[model samples]
Target: MNGTLTLDGFCHRLAADPLRYRKLHPVAMAGEFVDHFGVPPFPRMEGIAGLLDRSGIGTVVLSHETGGLRGYHVGTRDGGYLIHVDASEGRVGQEHTALHEAYEVMRERLHDLHPRIGLAAGISLCRQADRFAAATLMQPYWFAIFAEASGLDVVALQASYGRSYASLTIRLAEVMRHQPLLAVLYERGPQAERPPGMPGQVSEGLRATVVARTPGFRLRMQRRPLSALRGLLPRRGAPPPPGSVAERVALTGRPAAVDRVSGYDLWRADDLAVLARPVIWGGQVAKVSVVAVPYRDRSVLLPQFANAAFERTFHAHQVL
Candidate 1:
């Protein structure tokens, strides 16, 4: 079997013997998933796109008006997958989806190899594979390092890992020298102690004061107050629906989708303000925080940063 036949055969084989094929695959942290697949980690998914391109698959960003739907991966008979993702989610999120699609393809191939193997029948095996892939790609180890380095505690850990939000805060805290922030937040006890909205909505006055007191944190206020959040407008359109991404982040004290602004440091500028710098001892994001920026200001800042902060922060803290 070669070319089209080989591809078809591979898919069929996986479908036939899903268990046997899945068994051979290695599992690690989410970061390892990217590494093993010859792609970059979550926050840097261009590597994944590059890999897809090399395989003759085109990853395009087409508007919904152009018959493009979000969150669907369409595989061409020629052995390529065309993945449509929301522009807002960007490459990191999209790459995770792509990896998921690839895993399905691999599964099909495994089943084809052993027609009698039913991964569906072996629920444990299927679940284990998924956990392995998610854990590997999420790179919890790196996340742990960045968290500790930043001085984050269990409560802060929820912000970094509990939600679907990107995990860059830990790493950014490490790089920015904000371990004390994490220390302070953790020392404050469980986040449950604070009013639900309080932790995520640090005031600007508080931000200024905390940074002022923590000289070692290395945060320099940009000469210009950050470009206001209004800059993210869709050009003369209604603002995002009520309960938008920023709103969610603010309420949860967790990094949310809004953190993926194109230029801002996702970890430092989102709903959770930067009171301190994150540390990256070893290869992960450690504990870090600041006095907390007001929810409104942090909301504004989120539009300018990329998701890199999540991975950077998480990786930095995890090492610590």
Candidate 2:
């Protein structure tokens, strides 16, 4: 499939055998695509541009004006593609939009099959391109290594990878599909309601908490008081401790290191400690944190939880 796994090809495959493609991880597929194109690992912005140029995109234009539309891609008279990005959206947003447009341009088969492909197919293709761009920007292997090394801190991972919080949050969910011990929470405001599209309901006067966890881990959390801590879901009763790391980070927009606490401080577990960091969005503080059973092994200093797949993959790739 070298040099041939175009966006349209992936969409066709997904349409023909939805379950098969659904089971495959987006990051892994994107890594394979990069490897096939011979792009360097952990490609930077310039590298991504180069890849786009090679994939048939001719020019990338950035507009500083703020508008309703983030960006768009269009075919020029010369049969080349031009991508226009909204620079006003900032660096991370511009990068994401550019990559998404580039992927759209690379869907050579889509143009050929446009007349035959209906609206549903077109939507699927668009969704596939979005995922492809995200995975390309945040390569799975690099992200996995960074997650482990950075103690699963979303802010640190965002700095290291130069990804937007939204992108990093989505990628975290993708990574959690393989790492059961991993979970990420986004607390929007002091008493923010549950984020739109997130499952479960929050208790009155509580802040929003969107939890993303692996299936088994989520099931285990569900069996306990932490059931409300399920993926992107809110807790059913009571707010977290006011002095808890999550609350402190939300209020102060600062990082906090805390010892294990009782009664909904985090996961309702006595053994788990937390490192909470504020996720700043639109100049406002959004509390985000990483939780894990504290590490007992001398080999690692930070919390080390059991994740066989993550351990095997990390060791095999020498990412740790």
Q: Where does model 1 exceed 4 Å of error? A: 1-35, 41-43, 55-70, 121-133, 151-320
List the candidates' TM-scores in order: 0.36, 0.63
RMSD of each: 17.1, 9.0
Clashes of each: 99, 1
Q: After superposition, how far is residue 168 of candidate 2 from its true place, in Å?
A: 1.9
Candidate 2, position 302, lDDT: 53
* Number of the predicted model whose lDDT against the real structure is largest: 2
lDDT of 2 by residue, 1-320 (tens): 43444454444544455363433344554655676566665666566666666655547777765366788877889777777878677666777777777666644544355534332247676676678778887776777887777656676677787776656766776764555443446555454465554333332233435445554343233455643544322332333343345555555566555443333324543233445565666887644554433222112215323221111111111000
Give the per-residue lDDT digits (tens) of candidate 1, residues 40-147. Answer: 334445665565455443454433442443345566787565656556555445555555444544555455556665444355544444444445454645665644
Task: Give model 1's TM-score versus the native structure.
Answer: 0.36
